[model samples]
Target: MMQNHEEHDHHENGSELSEMQLRVRALETVLAEKGYIDPAAIDVIIEAYETKVGPHNGARVVAKAWSDPVFKQALLANASEAIVALGLMNRVGDHLIAVENTPRQHNMIVCTLCSCYPWEVLGLPPVWYKSAPYRSRAVNDPRGVLADFGVALPADTAIRVWDSTAETRFMVLPMRPAGTEGWSEERLATLVTRDSMVGTGLPKNPKDA
Candidate 1:
């Protein structure tokens, strides 16, 4: 009976893997036929993930932290449970933490060991994010790296650099941009960019662009 159960489990796993491959192949075929997928279409996919599969988990947390002081405290104290409380615990690994960036202290995240991230919330890390130069320089010279990204901080502001190891991953809770008071959550989410979450850029106001 034990051997039979093992075989059944293996079969089910193989079937699921096959289905995933088929879906990937279909997507590749569509991309090939189009010659190039629109960047806006990628945004649409990201939006769908945020709505359906919950890709904007970190963004939602940031928004909540902005509005609620208690939750923000909890997030700072224990990010893994705080995020799980927000219904974002379906991802693969554990050890997810949130770092907040304030006016006085700016926080940046980098994985020197590997490209570890909170993908359930932030989606895929950009190509530059995973590049060796970014990983190496971000921790050694954060101000210089941010300068390269065109993000300038005041001389009084202190930059806190967090290194993500093999076990724990980090995300940045960006300071809410100015001039976006009394906005709905949906509208606020539009301002939260991947770069902002990665601590490379600030959230852009609708009026700015």
Candidate 2:
């Protein structure tokens, strides 16, 4: 009986090994035939995920805020609650914080320890955003960091840098772009890029890319 039990255990272990081997073989075949994965492929995959399953919902929220004064006030007052009101607080470990950007005060966000982003609202952070240079330097020298991103603020313009924690996430509510006077919400959402929502880039105008 003991020998039979040992044989059963060996069979189970062998089955598991075979399953793993099959998976590895399949992966190897795909890799060799399809060629090694491209680094740029990661960006394309992430962009696809963002379009299919991420912060596009929040883009609608921002567009609504831009068009409606009351919603904008609610969003500015309590971003997490406002987002919940829009039925978009579904992701785990996501805590939303809104930072408003204005002519006088521009807001930028960074996480020094890790990439703690408001993925529900802004999708994945850009590559530069997760870099150590950006995280370490943004808090200490916000103006310079913005300058590096090609955003040169006026000397008098106050820059507010919000450091996100693992438990809390943040997004930038960019000032509504000019000349978008009568655009629909969907049209406005087109201008809201992930970079603009992260404060590293401004919303693209109708003419601008």
Candidate 3:
């Protein structure tokens, strides 16, 4: 069976894409053609950097914080400044906040109004993050939302949901897992996941990684 000319170029398979995503794809196609880049490679590049598909920058921050106490303190006190020092600042937002998770408490972020995220750290916000259901449920039933992501916190640990505004954005600094005590920052960063910083998942255990 031979594919039609139109079908050969079409990527969507009866799936609906938001107008923004569609526009991004259009722009991506134009740029790739102009630069003589492969279209498939474009998707991988966008997923790794443009979209919130990877923990490239935030993983470094989380890993460093886990290894360096002084840096951790500075990051907690002023996220925007700390990341800027590491040259990770990329116009994420007007303000950036780092929230730490502890044995007694967990922090989750949500933009009830819109998706205001630390793009440089976490890449862009995920589609789900911008959805009405997530924006509403994240605040109303944070534990349930975490559960949906397969993260079950201890009953004793309190869950705190932070609402992100256009002027401010928040990122979760998940507690380091045990058995990773002596891990190097590079190795530890491999354990950090995009969802962990988003507050919906935990870093991978050393054994798992």
Model 2, span 1-209: residue lDDT tens: 00111211111222222477579667766876687865467567865665454545667878889999998999888888887887756542356778888888877777643336676566666667778999777766777777787887777778777766655667899889889999899899888877778787788877773
Give candidate 1 misplaced runs (Cα > 4 Å): 1-54, 88-92, 112-115
TM-score of each: 0.69, 0.71, 0.73
Candidates' C-alpha lDDT: 0.71, 0.71, 0.78
Q: For candidate 3, lDDT tens digit of each residue in 65-92?
A: 9999999999999988888787765444
lDDT of 2 at 7: 16
Residue pairs with colliding backbones in model 3 are none
The residue-by-residue lDDT of candidate 1 on 26-77, one tens digit each, is 8867986787766557656755654344355666777777777899899888
In model 3, which runs have C-alpha deviations exceeding 4 angstroms?
A: 1-55, 90-92, 112-115
After TM-score superposition, the amount by which residue 128's alpha carbon in candidate 2 deviates from its true location, in angstroms, is 1.6
Q: Give candidate 2's whole-model lDDT.
A: 0.71
Say which prediction, candidate 1 or candidate 3, comes out ahead on lDDT.
Answer: 3
